[model samples]
Target: MFTRADLGKDERLDLMEFTLVLEHLGLSWTRAETQDRFEKADANLDGFISYAEYRAILEAQGWV
Candidate 1:
């Protein structure tokens, strides 16, 4: 999932790639909702979602 979501193939997900991840999960979050969640998921405040960060988010949301 991370690989697929990392459309840039840079080993991290930008906002656009993260949106693709939500779509892959069949989530229909509003743009604002996604942005909010994305901000929360970016633990390091690095402006991208690392694999560790993504996993943490999934765990927090009980999705993993």
Candidate 2:
């Protein structure tokens, strides 16, 4: 799922790509909600979610 959203193929996801992942999951988050989730998943706050961060969030959310 993360791989599919990684349009840049940089092994990380930007805000837009993350949003698409949410959409793909049939989730409809407001901009603020999306940002908030992104911020939490981006443990380092480096403006991108690495695969480790992504998987961590999923595991934390009990979605994996």
Candidate 3:
């Protein structure tokens, strides 16, 4: 999932890549919901979600 979402292959997911992951998962989230999830995963608010953060979020969602 992390590799798939890291579209840029930068080992991190920017907002666009995150959105793609949600879409790929067929998760229909509102704009606010998506932003909220992104913010939660991006613990450092660095505008990117690292593999660790992505894994953490997936684990929290029971998807890991």
Whole-model lDDT per candidate:
0.94, 0.94, 0.90
Least well predicted 10-residue stretch by lDDT in candidate 1: 1-10
RMSD of each: 0.7, 0.7, 1.0
Tens digit of per-residue lDDT, candidate 3, span 1-64: 7797787999999988999999988999998999999998999889999988988988899996
Q: State the lDDT of candidate 1 residue by residue for 1-64, as single tens digits.
A: 9998787899999999999999999999999999999999999999999999999989988998
Q: Looking at model 2, which ten-residue stretch has the lowest summed lDDT?
A: 55-64
TM-scores for every candidate against the unseen true structure: 0.95, 0.94, 0.90
How high a TM-score does candidate 1 get?
Answer: 0.95
The CA root-mean-square deviation of candidate 2, after full C-alpha superposition on the true structure, stands at: 0.7
The TM-score, computed over Cα atoms with residue i paired to residue i, of candidate 3 is 0.90
Q: What is the alpha-carbon lDDT of model 3 when measured against the actual structure?
A: 0.90
- For residue 54, model 3's alpha carbon misses the true position, in angstroms, by 0.3
